[model samples]
Target: MFDEMLHWPFFDERHRALRALGDWADSALDDLVAQEHAGGDVYALTPQFVARLGEAGWLRLAASLDGRLDARSICLARDMLARRSGLGEFAFAMQGLGSAAITLFGTPDQRERYLRGVMDGTRIAAFALSEEGAGSNPGEMEMAARRDGDAYVLNGEKTWISNADLAHQYVVFARTGEADGARGLSAFVVEADAPGLSVIERIPVIAPHPLGTLRFDECRVPASAMIGAPGDGFRIAMSVLDVFRSSVGASAVGLARRALDEALKRAAARRIGGRALADYQMTQDKIADMATAIEASALLVYRAAWVKDTTGARTSREAAMAKLFATEQAQGVIDRAVQLFGGLGVTVGMPVESLYREIRALRIYEGTTEVQKLIIASGLLAAASHGN
Candidate 1:
């Protein structure tokens, strides 16, 4: 179903190769959910899964030497992975999200030390930004890093962190200056074994992964551990999000595509009044709506990714638009698929039911639907104010 979309002018030879690679990578993940659950601890299984992705060299696409991320490739990889396994998508995305700051802003030494391990699958990476009081508004983060001689002592907590205890290193954001709001923040590379760092709690959400709360009690890291200069944390965080946000939309598109496929199969096989479900006008209408939304979402997602790859400009507005439409529409599309499946849709262990759980968090994470709307509105207002 997604093959035709790859032929669109928005994609190129490299994008096609990435899609092919993703397909190959995903073929082995058929039992990822079961494998994860087999250990009786889904979070504990994340490191092994990430290692597999790294060993396959699929993680190389997530990082680049020139400090430029290929949004199109990332979107393709995420879309393909999401279609097959949510855990696969999560592992791939965390690799990118966790290491994006280092790729974009790390010093040569930092890159050499971390990037190699991250790409090789020997080491896991994570991004630590949200706090107890800060989610949508990261500017209110209370995690503070106080400079002490040759090191910075980190003292606070980060919650809802993916790959929390499993990551080898974390791109930790903390307040470093007296300036109010986000201006005071800075980014740091905190090793997992750092003296004061500990996983205080594990959090289980609708979709399971390695999520937990991290406590930094006077966790001292060398000043050399900082990703960029002081007060650059907010900038780095946004920059990373700007690159990855559209890919989140692409993932949603993939999940929706899978849902639609399942619905079509169900509709074709299930009979109503001695006729196929697909023969019914209402069923046709639902299928039409699902296909239309998926196509529109693909366009928006790929357009945003293309702009970022070609123009090298901040894609705040475009990314927001793509993420907003794709995630919201995916929920609707999946819901329709559930309806089509009737009782089986709501039943445990069904593909559509699993998708229902997986797609819900995409809207809440990365950035919420409400946050995307605000971003789009703010962009429009700013453009109007500038008379552009």
Candidate 2:
């Protein structure tokens, strides 16, 4: 798979090893699909998928060999899994995202409790940041975390939370006080079994990833559950997003490549007007454009991953650029692939159609394309004015 494209320059031997692991995923995807079909239980299937990944030691690729959460590893894992199956990628991505706060800022005790589960896939992880009223505006979150004796009582509703009903724990965000917008907020690690916490509703999307609303009604936890410090949730969330957003882009690249591969195979075999579809210049142009876009998106996505891994930089701007460009370009490539496939593209269960739906959410999640643009422009302007 790595040799099939020109976007590999950003990767190293470690990344190649991870890419090779995709062979196991490709071989086993049929079994996974069959099981999901027989059971129709995303919650159960997802955990098993994670466990399988962990048992193969592929879940360890979500972090680093030394146990640090390396950004490049996360990117490569997402890319490979996404190429094989969207659910596979979603399952891998959430483990890292749900546990990122702990990996980055947790105390030794916190890491031992959370990171172990994440690495071993014994526990599923989740990030609960988006509220109905505060989807894009963090300052608008109404969920309040009030101090009560030695514990913090969390009261808020978080909707569209990934792995909502399935996750064993969540890194939840809530406002501690109203000192300032986006400043009074704090992050906490809350157990799924925590009192007053419940899965209010399950939201189904075109893809089969798990999502739902979580209600924290006087949900209380020890102060030790707080990540970083009170009034620091906004910073922590942004820092975590910076690391994972690029991987979202990389996933998009993988999906786009799968679409392109399907298109190429179909075009080479299908005969139209007494000739193969490949004989037509129009078909050739579409293939060329799709291939170019795929490579370009992959480069941008992995470049961001590489920058974050090597320099340990904040990478907000680079990640935003990657997510923004790669997602947009990937959508275009998928659209072209569907066009190339003609009638077969829109057919249900076809790889291109599946990818079309799968790629749409990546643009919205992790930070929307518009949000990424604003981030990039704001950073550019700030850098220009500061001359640093």
Candidate 3:
């Protein structure tokens, strides 16, 4: 089912990545899967996975040296990876998200210093944009950075950051003015060991990953560490997200596909009343709906990626639609898979049980489903007014 979707014009060339990457993942990421099923220490496992992915050259797909990203490739990579393991997709996605600002809008010196480390997986990276009050609304950010001589002294905290304590470097956004809201924000690169910066609290989500809050009390970073110019943080962050948001949808497609596959296999094998579960009309109805939703989501995912890669346009409307539908629907697909498995589905260590936990966070992060609706409607209103 997934292979057929690759024939879409969006991925004529990049679709080739699926086969090789999928084969590599099944073999190389087996240990990661076993660890996740056993509820292993995700923090300890993160670096090991990064090193392995880097050594295998998989991380290179996430870093764009020329500052031109191929969204289809990114979507394909995320789709294949998420189907296998949630943590695997998280590791790969962070390499791109953490350094995307630098890759797209950094000085030559900045790129030379940081891009390669992430591509090679030696530098685990984090994107610190969400503060306690700014999870969905970044404009409400209270984290501040005051200019001190040639350095910027940062203060306040960023919470719910992925790859938190495990990251070697962070792409941080903070307020730089008195009260201009998001317009006063600036983006900067700060190493983990930077003075006066520390992980204040580790946050455990429904799924396993390194998430936490970081506090900066007079943390001084060189002025050169800034990505783009002052007042460019909001633009830079939005630009980066515009490209990666569709990739999030692709990840949802992968998760949904995996759920569908699990459901189909179980229906074929599990029997009741002296017949296979797949023989029942109720089971067949579910299989049909899950397949339809997966295909619809996959089309939206690739369409958004294609528009970004080919047209170089801001995919606010398209990406939001893709994200809103894919994540929300994938949750439903995975839930049905769990119901199909009955008592065994809720049991820990079962594949559907793990997936149930994994699918919940995707809806909440990046941009929430509610946030996506606003974006889509805003785009529609703007387009209508412009007569486009």
lDDT of each structure? 0.90, 0.86, 0.89
Runs off by more than 4 Å, candidate 1: 33-40
lDDT by residue (tens digit), candidate 3, 146-256: 888899999999999999999999999999874487788899999999999999899988788999999999999999999999889988989889878888998898898
Which 10-residue window in model 3 sums to the lowest lDDT? Answer: 10-19
TM-score of each: 0.97, 0.95, 0.98
lDDT of 2 by residue, 1-388 (tens): 4565424666667666665667888776668856653435787789988888877777776643243667777887787788887887888999889888887877788888777777787889999999998998899999999999999999979999999999999999999984789999999999999999999999988777899999998899999999998898999998899889999998998888788889889999999889999999999999898888877887788788888888987999999999999999999999999998888889877788888889999889988999998999999999999997
Worst 10 residues of 2 by lDDT: 61-70
Scored against the true structure, residue 215 in model 2 reaches a CA lDDT of 96
Residue 264 displacement (Å), model 3: 0.9
By the TM-score metric, which is better: model 1 or model 3?
3
lDDT of 1 by residue, 1-388 (tens): 5889989999888788776665576566555657753433666566767787888888898875567678999999899888877887888899899999999999989988988898888888999999889989999999999999999999999999999989999999999985889999999999999999999998988777779999999899999999999999999999999989999999999999999999999999999899999999999999999999999999999999999989988899999999999999999999999999999999877889989999999998888999999999999999999998
**Could you give the candidate ranking by TM-score, starting with the highest?**
3, 1, 2
lDDT of model 1, residue 229: 93
- The clash tally of candidate 1 reads 0
Given candidate 1, what's the lDDT at residue 254? 90
| Candidate 1: Cα lDDT at 57 | 86
